[model samples]
Structures are given as C-alpha cells and as structure tokens.
Target chain A: MQIRDLVRRRTPLGWKQLVHSKGRMAIATAGVAFAVLLIFMQLGFMNMLFESAVMIHRQLNADIVLVSSTSRDFASPGTFPRSRLLQAVGVPGVADAEALYVTPRDWIKQSETNRGERAQMLMIGVRPDFAAFRDPEIAAQLPLLVETGTALFDRKTRGNFIPFRQAIERGERPQTELGGRTVTLVGTMQIGSSFGSEGVLIVSDQTFFEFALNRVPSAPSVGLVNVAPDHDAAGVAAAIRARFGTYDDTMVMTMEDFIEHSKGRMRRDSAISFVFTFGTIIGMIVGVVIVLEILSADVHDHLAEYATFKAMGFSNRALLGVVFEQSLILSVAGFVPGLLVSLGLYAVVRSALTMPIAMTVERLVLVFGLAVTMCALSGALAMRRVRKADPADVF
Target chain B: MELSRLSHWYGAGETRRQVLFELDLVIPRGEVVFLMGPSGCGKTTILTLVGGLRSVQQGSVRVAGRELAGANEARLIANRRQCGFIFQAHNLHRSLTARENVRMGLEAQGRGLPPDADERSERMLAVVGLADHANKFQHQLSGGQRQRVAIARALVAEPPLILADEPTAALDRQTGHDVVALLRRVARERGMTVLMVTHDNRVLDFADRLLEMEDGRIVAARPGAAAAAPVNP
Candidate 1:
C-alpha cells in the first residue's frame, strides 16, 4: 500500500473532528497552554528561589567552613571569634584558615530630588592577600578592594542600580554610602542578590569593620579553611568539630554540609515549597478539567458516528484510539505555543524580579511530559461515552 | 443466515416487554430480501439479531455459519466484519469526507491494507454516483448524496452479506428509488445477500422477495412484484 493510504488507514476519525472545529480547537489549545504556562512559571520560580538561597555557599572558596554554633543560616549567620579560625589552622591536615565577615550594611542612594533611599546591602569581607570569592570577575578585581575606601558592587543587585553600574562601566567612580561611610564603587561583578539582602558589596576586612556599625574586630561571621592536598576535607572538618565541641563556640562543617544546612533552613522558613508544589498540582488539575470538557463534548457530538464504527466491527480499543489521538494532538499543539510564551514570560520575570528564572532542558522535558499525561488522563476518562455507544441503539 | 425461535426484550423483570417473539426465519445467500413493517413491529430487532448487533435472547441466530446466541464481543466483532450495515440516518462521520467514510469499512476488516484499498474505495464511491463528491464532508452533501456515500461505505469491502435498516428513510421518493436500484445492482453484481428493512413502498419493486412483519412475527411472504419484471441495469 502507498504510504499515504497506510497512514490514513491508521489515523482515527477523532483527529478530523478536532481540526474541523476551528474555534473550539483554538480555545482548547489556549486552555492547555495556560495550564502549561502556570506549571512552567511555578517551577522556574521555585528553581530560582533554591538557586538564590545557595548562591553564596556555591561560590565559597573554601572546602570546610566554621560558623557560630547558634547561626541559623547564611543570611543571618552569627559571628564567631577570629581565634577559632586560628585554632582550626593548628589542626593536622589544615593547609590554612581565613576569617570572613558578612553583615548587611545600609546602602544610601540619592535620587533626582536629592532625597536619599536606604537599602540593606550584604557585605563580605576577606583579607587582601587570601582572596575568598571564587568568581573570575570578582577575583580579578580583588586588588581594587585592597585600595582604601573602594568596594566591588554586585551588578545583578535589585533596585535602581543601573545608573551606578553605567557610571562604573564608563570607567568613572560613582560613590555610594555604606553605613554612613563614603565608599567608592570601583568595580562591578555578577554575584546575584538574594531575598534576605537587596544588594551586595565586597570589601576588605578592615573596610568592613569601618563600614559596619557595631561589629567587633576580633569576631568574624564565618571561618574558611582549606584542607591539605593529601587530607580528606570531611575528615578534617570532623576533627575540628571534635576538638572544638567541648570548649569552643564554633560550628565546624564541610562546605557541602554548610550549603545543605542553609537549604534545609530555607525550606523550613520560606513558603517556596507550598507555592511551587501546590501550583504544579493545581495546573495539572486545571488542564485535566479543560481537556475532559472538550473531549467529552467532542465525543457527545460524534456519538452517532462512533456507533456506526462500532456497528462496522470496530473494537472498543480501536474506537478509543480516536480520543487518544485527539488528546495527543492537543498536547503537542498547545505545548509549543506554551513553551514559546513561557520563554518570553521567563525573561519578563527575571528582569522584573531580578530572580534567576531559567529554562533548563530538564524543566522543558518535565513540563512537556506533564502536559501529555494531563491530556491522556482526560482522554481516558472521556472514553466512558465511547463505551456506551451501542451499535444497536444507534441503528 | 438463520434464526429459529429467536426472541429479545428491553427491560428487567416486571418492565420487560419482548420485542421479538420466537422469530423463525432463514434467508438464502445471494438473495435480496426486503422486510416491510410499521413502527414497533420488531423489524429492526430481528435485523440487529441477524447482523450480530444485539444478543439473541432465546433460540438461535446463525449468520455466516457462526452461532450468535451466546457470542461474546470478540465473536460478534468477528461476525460483523463479514457483514455491511447501512442505517436510516446515513451515519457518516461528519469530520470525514465521503471517501474516508468508505475507507473505514475496508479498514474494519482487520486484514492488513490491500494495495488497492484506496483506489477500490474511490471506485465504489464512483459506483454510488459520489465520485465527484468524495472529498466533500457529510454536512456539505445533500440528503440523497449522503445516503449514496453510506451505500458506498457499505459495499466498499465487498462483504458476503449487507443488512440495511431504513437505508433511504431521509430521502425523497426519487432519491429513495434510485438508492434501492443502486443497492439491487450492486448486490446482484457482487452476488451478495441483502436483508433490508424499509417502510417506503416505492422501492419494494427492487426486492427479490418481500416479507411483511407485524407485532414481532412475519405475517406474509411472497415474491416481490419486481422479481418478475426486469430490473434496470
């Protein structure tokens, strides 16, 4: 048989029924697309939230970290004595240790009316010689931080920092006040902002002590440690924790454990879990309902035709194939437009919210698979009417 | 085909009203028989039984050598593949064109597609005088043309038997007569047996034999008046 005829023979009549109604098909496709958009957006936001929560930890330049035993998370990590870092360096398998200070400083920006708006800015402080940040852009600018009264600014920080960014890009210094201290923005980097901190600044430990209002000089927020080449990082972290457990007031952990601790804390404190997980379920339910209504109506409209086929010896399986074909067509047709629209939406949300909304291949495949399952389940449920079509009754 | 003491009912226990009363009938192969009856006379019930569309409640119904009295859906589907059924409503799928509807009949046979299935479907459409309208959907066709498409669908697979329930009920007198004449020519040309139920008296002349039904039993059987006359080729 010719390929055309062979294909036509296998194609069920439901496909024709779906395409024949131009208005209904468009409406059905739009409904499915809306549901898909909901799911994609929710998943994108959730992923961005998680990535942002671990942004600093992921870029940390140390294998093991020390924190205050009472520290909740990186956002509000309590300070520990700098002596703990010195003590950690004395342990075996310890290459070196550094003190890193993190605190949210008040950033003041002057608007057109000469009125200043104050925003909280997260500031990280490390020694000039042992640069702690891992980003190539920031690492390249480490020497600039060593200069007195200068700090590197995060270009991705939220709010109206575009003027300052443009000024720095033009190779001119734009000064901003941090905790009432006159600090010049010497360079810009791509470290992202987070929910807890609206913007970020990188300064030397001495500059941080100068910019931060009530920070003690002997204490640091976190302690960074590098394991010796032949030593296991986790083993050294355990050794430090064991040696410090009795007297010292520091929490010792490998970098990965620190990241997980922050992530676990965020999951417990934030509403991200409820919004994304529940949102996806709601989207699927909406899709199934819309598809069920449309497919059921299509089946009802073609009851006589289905009965005729049944009378002509079509099995229930063959007849059900028609419904399934319609559903698959709807899924594929709707998903392409939904994906295209969501790309535009992701761009809008990322720009507007300064969040890391991205379209990964894994998310794309996941949402498409979900769309198909939603439509398939609807088709299966709508087959009830097809089963009731008795050939004798139609005659 | 044969039916001996076959009966059927519609409802449960007290509400059950038997539609067919011990119907005993036999139709020979290659004969075109028309069943004439008023509404509620059980013409359709017996036709459904013979076509394996309904279960035989009592006695036996054998079509093409298979007993259908206790047959399951698979058996019924297998038996149905051997027969072509045409209905009063010209129940063509509205989404499909005239040619596609005819192709469904051949597809129902479950044998893999024959090389000429599409061409054969077109040829059958041409035979029913719908060759030019093969691509036209059901709603786009007139009443006569729709019935012609239904006829093309019924005969496309060249089954051994054809069962038609009020095949031309929706057409006018001339369309009705033309439809029956087309059916008679095709049945004779293919040597296919046909059992048709109709209330229209104008097409009675095309039947090789006629049986009159009343209240669930056959009241009269005689040679069709047209059997003695030459049927138009």
Candidate 2:
C-alpha cells in the first residue's frame, strides 16, 4: 500500500487516548523529560572531562612528541636525556627538534592585594627561538622570554590572580617569586587550565636551570619534533620509535596519538569517567521504569475499552500498534524540552569552569537514539498487559 | 445461524460446573430473536458463543456459513468481523465522538478504516436518529442517546448478524422501547439477523420470536406479538 493511503486509513487511536486526560499527559511528559535531562547532563559532563584533559595537547606546535616511557600523564613529567632531541634531528623527514623542560613549582603571589599567597603552577622552559605553541599570540611573546627572569603567564589559570593579571594588562611588569627567586611576568598566554594543572608559567631555558636547582641541564621533560613539508608525521614517528626500540627510557608518538593516549589514560585511571557513565545508565533505567509505569497505568485504565476492540475483531498486533505509537509520541515530546535545558546548562558550566564543554551533532543524535530505544523497551514490557485483554470479558 | 448440541463448562476438572447444556436452535436470516431467562440460565453464554467472542467447546456453532467449532484465533477473529455486538452498558469509548465510535465498527474488520468511513458512520447515526449528536462524546450524550450510538456502531459495518446482550437494560422504560424499536427497524431495513438477550419485558414485543430458557435448556419457543403483522421493512 502507498504510505499516504496507509496513513489515511489508520485511526490515530493512541493520540486520542493520550490527549483524553490532560493532567495525565502532562505528568507523563514531565517524567520522561526529567530522565532525558539527567542523561544529557551526565553525557555532557563526561565529554567535557575528556575535552579538558587534551586542551594543551591540541595547542602544541609539534607534529610528533616524545615523552619519558615512565610518564603516566602531563602531571608526571619523567625526564629523558636532551641528546635524544639532538639525535631526532638527524633522522629523515625531521625538520627541527626542541627540548621542553616541565615541572610543578610554588609561585608566591606578589600582588599588593594578595602578597605571599603561594599557588602550585606548571612551569614550561623552552629555547627562546623555538616555536613551542600553535597559538600565534603565544608565539609572538616568545622573543620576550630571551631575557633572564622574564616569563609569560597563562591568563586562563584557575586560582585568584586578578591583581597580577591586571598588572600585566596595564603593561607594568609584575614580579612573582618562583622557587624563592623573583621572576618578571612579561606577557600572557591563553592556554586554559585543566584538572592536572591550575596555572602555567613559561620561561627561557637559561632561567629554568636557575630556579630548578635539583634538575640537570642535560635532562628535559619532553622532546618536540616538527616533520618537514611533504613528510607524514606518522611515518617519522614510526622511524623514531624504531631508532629508540631498545631504549626503555622514552616513548615516541604522533601528536594525534599522544592526545588520544592522554584521554585514554584519564578514562582508564579516573573514577570521574566511571561515575558519569554510571549516571547515564541510571538515567536510562529511570526513564524505562517511568515510561513502563505510565503505559501500564494507561492500559489498566482502559482495559474494558481494549476488550471492546478485541470483540470488534482487532487482533493483538493491531492493539499493540496503539501502545507503540504512544511511546513514540512520548519520546519526541519529552526530548525537545530536555535538549533545550541541557544546552542552557552546558553554557553555564562552560563559562563557570572555563572548561571545553559544548554540544556536538554526534552527541545530539546519540542521545536521541538512546531516548527512542528506552521508550521502545518500555513499550515492549507494557504490551504484555495489552495482550491480556479478553474479548469475552467485555460481556 | 445455527447451534446444535452446544454445551459449555466453567473452571477446571476439580471445580467444573456446566453452564450450557446440549441445546439446539436455529435463527433464520433477517429474523429478530430475543433470548429471555432468569439470571444464571446461560442467556449471555449463547450470545457470546454465537458472536465468536468465546470458543465453542462442544458441538457446532455455524454463523454466516462458517463453523466456529475448533476454529483458530485468526479464523474466529475473521468470523467476528461478519457480526456486530452490543453490550449491557453502551460500551462506547469515551475518548471518541459518537461518529468516531460508530466508525470503529468498520475499522475493526481487521482492515484499515474505509475511505468513506465518515460518511458511512454519519449515515448510520442518521438512521438511528442520532445525526445531531454525531460529534458529541459519550459523556455528552444522555443514557438513551449513548445506547442509540451503540446501536449505530453495531450496525454501521452492515454485518450479516448482530448479537446484543442486555442492550437496553440500562435505559429507562420509554428510552428502552425507542432503542429496541430503532434496532428492529435498522436490522429489518438492512436484512440482518439479530439475537438479543434481555430481561426487559417492555421491549419483548419488538422481537419476531422469543426463546425462553431455564437451567441451560430452552423451555419454550413461540412467535412474538409482532410476528403476525410484519413491520414496514
């Protein structure tokens, strides 16, 4: 049969039944919407966690990155020999290689408003001439780091640094104590904060050795390699891995793989990912139960009517169509409000925490698919009651 | 319609009790027959069996040239489509209007709604003197009007037979008489056979034949008051 003819012939019995009682429809819609909202929130937070963890990796200028094999994540910066970077430059397709020294150090806030307030911040030391960041604004400020005691500050840092930031904004160099030595903040970079580090400070390699007393100059935390034009970064990374195959002290990977590895580590080692995933499953369960209750009650309320339909020659499958239609209607009706509310909540969280949380088309489609599946499951369970309607009972 | 040696029981082996004894009866086409008896005399059981609402346990129930004995669920449903049914209370769906309720009769034939179902339902409602109340819900209609709508629904599909159980039992005296008269007129006009079960004596005169039952057996059968003079068909 043609689609139009089929639709014209079928009575919208489910719609009429649902709209018969306005109060019940409203309650049912609200119940489904609440569950949808819960699922959206959990999924949104989980994506944000992964996005925040890889914010810095996405901004790095290197096509390939080399890290210590013992390093678990950005927080655990196990050092390797600086000579590894020198050796990497001799390999085919290697354009340039640079050494990056990273460590967490106590920064004594030296603003008149909050003097001597110490905060732990990540410090990155690099050669002044090397392009260390993909952000052009940070790259432009690299030349200022050529002077000793000069450093760049991350403006998106998490803690209270309003006074220090304002001082830099006014073009006045603000002096802050790092490792008990005063350093001048010459510029600001916009690399946002993550769960691992609340703030970042960048200085030249010469000043890095003066502040890090326990570290040797020959050992750097990371090796950055830029592939020459027309050379694939993955191939170069593979060659680097082959060159260091027997050496267990360092690991090499393409930048894309490095970002994924970081995200995978967070997902595997952090309880937050599990908590959010569990919450999402719980939301789906709650949705199924609520829809089942609504549909079961609707069937119970109209059992006699269903029996009358049976007596009139309706088959069990025909009766089930009515219920499944109701479930589809509820899923669509509830999903709209749930999605709108979630968007607003995502905005609130994005601004409040400076976190990389935003809506994507994939997430929207996934959640909608989940909502439909949840309602369909409930419809199947509720159909058991509809099949019990006996035609003879109507008499 | 014919019923031969029909017998039925309720419950399992331990608590079994016979409800219908071995009975024999035949209802010719276009005849309006009423089955009357005291309570617990199998009046409704006969209607259920003849309507294909219940399985015929023992003996044969043949309606519209189809045997219902040992019929599968699908076959029984097909048989039901050829018949109409009315209940004691006007079991109209409250969610639908009078016209929509009537249309359900045609829609329930295991086919989708017919293309001209609206006009057919409206015409059927007009036949039953309910044209003005076609758009009104069951709750909006009075008790007599609801019963009339039920009659419209039962006959809208133009079934070959109609089986009603206490169709006018919930209506008042005058309303009950008008409803039965309407039913008789419509059934006669359509050349449809009807088997109604009722205890109301006021509406008994509309039937062409009356079968009186006692203890699951037909005690007496005779022509009704209307049998001698046929109504204008």
Specify the highest-TM-score model's number.
Answer: 2
Residue A295, candidate 2: Cα error in Å is 1.5
Candidate 2, residues A1-395, lDDT tens digits: the string is: 68878886878888888999777777778877888899999988898888887787788889999898876666566899877778788899999999888888888865455678887778888898999889999889999998898899998887566777888868799887898999899998887777777778889989888888887768988888999999999999988877876887888989888888888888898898889989999999998999899989998888898999899888999899999998988889888888998999899887777788898999899889988888889988999999999999988
Q: How would you encode candidate 1's per-residue C-alpha lDDT over A1-395 as one tens digit per residue?
A: 47766675564677788888877789889989988999998898888887787788877789999999888787788999877888788899999889888988887863333337787888988887785878877788888877877888888887666776888878798887888889998889877888888767888888888887688768889888999999999999989887776866788989999988887877777899888899999999999999899999999988888888888988888889999999999998889999999999999988887777899999999999999999999999999999999989867
Error of 1 at B128 (Å): 2.3
Q: For model 1, which pairs clash?
A: none
Off by over 4 Å in 2: A106-119, A175-183, B231-233
Please state the CAPRI-style docking class of candidate 1.
medium
lDDT of 2 by residue, B1-233 (tens): 99999999989989998989999999999999999999999999998898888999999999988999999999989988888999998889988999999999999997789889999999999998988999999889999999999889989989999999998889999999999988988898889999999999999888899999999999999998878775673
The 10 consecutive residues of candidate 2 chain A with the worst lDDT sum are A109-118
lDDT of 1 by residue, B47-93 (tens): 78888888878999998888998999899999888899989989888
lDDT for model 1, please: 0.86
Off by over 4 Å in 1: A1-9, A63-72, A79-84, A87-96, A105-118, A140-151, A164-188, A210-219, A226-261, B111-115, B229-233
State the DockQ of every prediction: 0.58, 0.82
